[model samples]
Every structure is written in C-alpha cells, then in structure tokens.
Target: MTSAYWPLADLRIRSGPLELRPPVPAEYEVLADAAAREPHAHPRIPFLEHTADTPLRRGRRTLQWLWSDQGTWRPDQWSLTLAVFDQGQLVGVQNVRAAEFARTREVRTGVWVFQDRRGQGIGAHSRRALLHLIFDGLGARRAQYRAAASNQASLALARSLGYAEDLAPLTADDTVRHFSLTADCWRTRTDPVSTHVTGLAPALFMFGIGHE
Candidate 1:
C-alpha cells in the first residue's frame, strides 16, 4: 500500500538484532507514545525544547516532527527517519539526512533509543546501518555528525565508529563538536559490527540516486 506510492516505506536496514525502517501510518501514534514515555531532556542534546513541557506536548511534538519530515521530502534535500525496532518492538529512531547529496555526497545522522535500551549497543548498530546506507547503498563520499560538547555518549559513539573530529570552529555558542568519516575510512575501519541494507534498489530514486 504505502510502497505503491512511497517506495521509501519499503526500505529497511538490519544490523544485528536491530531493524530500521520508515514508520508506517499505524506506527505514527506508537512513535509518539514512545516519545512521551521517554522524554530526551539532556540540556546539551538538541531535542525539541517543548517536549519537556508535558507528556501530551511531547507526543504532539514528536508527531509534528515526523510528519514534517515526511511531507517535506525531496531528492535535493531530505531526511530519512527510521524507527528502530528490536524483535518487532519499537525501541527508538535513527535519522540520516543530506542536502544536495547528489553533488555534495555527504550525509549527517542522529539517533535516539529508549532509556531502557541504552548501553546495549543499540546506538552503535543503528549508526552502522545508516553508514552502510550512506556509503554503500547511496555511494556517499563522507558522513558527518554533530553533538553538543557535553554529550559524551554521542561523541563517544562517533569516535568508536572511526569518525575523526572536525577541526572547524564551532558556532558562536561553542557548544557543539563536529566529526566526519570519509567513505575510504569507513571501508577500512575495523569494527566487529556489520550491517545489511535491503530494498534499497527500489528506493534509491527517492534519494535522487541512480538518475546519473
């Protein structure tokens, strides 16, 4: 049904016990419920500020954010937000996005897992899947990441996945750190984790790939 109109709905990425896919209409409320249950409120981590106002607000914000991405998708600029599921249970979400990716060949990513699921290497596996999609499935040249300087977990994840810190100056706030991983580096990085992307061939056109 969804794949008949939006092929992206058919895309999936699997790494270990994790599965990443675009949330279907039925799962929209489920995603909002997850956000309400687990409000990510780290001051440094960039989350919707209004989410902490109330549980109802949190859920509303989550739905709005997801819908915005879905409605605004385009080949030149788009965000692919994948719901993370472990054994068919929704755990969290991982997002990979790019601007003019066909020419720039770069992408950025972010992830959020339920509090209970943290420290179980879910974040690492989710990222590996996105990297595979970026570099292998989409033929990206480099991948980028950004996190608040105080967000140790995010920075650690990037470093552990073989990303090098970017030397560029931070914004006026000087609160975020940037990192990058070239495709060559991703290919040679010795990480025990491996990922597989499926249904990508049918969705490549959605990402503006295979046109050239």
Candidate 2:
C-alpha cells in the first residue's frame, strides 16, 4: 500500500505516558529488536520456533499481512496495527481487529510491551489510547479482548479498563480468557486521555463509515 493508503497515517493517541501511532517502515527494525529482547512482553501469546530470534523477519511478515490487498479490508475484517512509542522510541505493538465484523461492528484488541518496560503502566495507557481510536475515532459500537487464562497481567489490565468478563469456549490450549467492552462503558471511565488523530475521517470512510 502506498503511504496515502495507510488509513491510520498521522493518527496518534496519548494516555498518561504513552503514544500510539502507525509504525513507520524505518522503525520496524527498532520494534523488532525490542520484541526479540523481550519474549515475555506478551505472556499470553505463544512464540513460534523462529519468532524470538528472528524479530525483524517477524516484523516484516506482520507488515505484509496487514497491508496485503488479498486480505479483506472491510471495516469488520480489517485490523489497524500500530507501534507503541515511549518518549519517541519503539517499545511495543497494539492491534484492533474485527471478525465477522460487517455484521457485528465489534472489534477485538491485543497489545504487547517490551520486557524492560513492564510495570511502568505503559501497557494500560497504550490500550486506552487504542480504545479511543476505535470507539471515538472509528465510530465502533463496541470492543472486545481476550487474554490467556494464566495471563494475570492482561486480565488485570482488561478489568482496569472496564472490560467485563465473557464466557468463551475452552481453547485447545485451554488458557485463553475472553473479555468484552461497550463504548458507553468505556466513556464512563475517568482515565486520562491524550491523542493526536489525523486522517481519521478519511480512514473511517475508507472502512465504510459514511460520516465521522
């Protein structure tokens, strides 16, 4: 996709101490290096055999998948994957995706932080920024998220952000927990909010929203 085709170009969000934006091509290596150094950054997601040692390759692959034209770009089937920055350095990745989305208007979010950055409240702030992007900027009706059953940190983050528990089926691994959130519920929370969102109107239109 051309730079102009990137829907989230120039979009940004801040929550307390974090900023979230689309990853520049030049920053991919930085993001990859951070991930390579911290496999525990995302405790719930399992690492593939080549993932820990080959983060640059993994980062490239993720970019390719996100930008692929063959993949559905409808509001429901698309994901806006962003790099999380702390004081201008790449530290993590966050994603908001829809499944069976056209009919549901519901999105799911996931996030990861560098190993060294844990306990600094970066994850929580980054996630809140993404929520604003989806619920306010993108006009999404609701959002959902899941964490591994054993990922206490993720569960805590979800609860802290007002995501209610949902009964999900047992995964093959039996370690996943599901959570859901509504826009109204999120708006009621009193978290600090900061963001710079540009091109959101165009991006939302590209995703099928007629009026922002």
Top of the candidates by lDDT: 1
Score residue 158 of candidate 1 by CA lDDT: 89
Looking at model 2, how many pairs of residues clash?
3
In candidate 1, what are the lDDT values of residues 69-151, reduced to their tens digit? 88999999998889999888898888888999888999988888877888988888788888888888999999888877888
Worst window of 10 by summed lDDT in candidate 1? 43-52
Q: The CA-based lDDT of model 1 is what?
A: 0.81
* lDDT, candidate 1, at 15: 77
- Window of ten residues with lowest summed lDDT in model 2: 40-49
User: What are the lDDT figures for the candidates, one per model?
Assistant: 0.81, 0.70
Steric collisions counted per model: 0, 3
Q: List RMSD in Å for every model shown.
A: 2.1, 3.5
TM-score, one value per model: 0.91, 0.80
lDDT of 2: 0.70
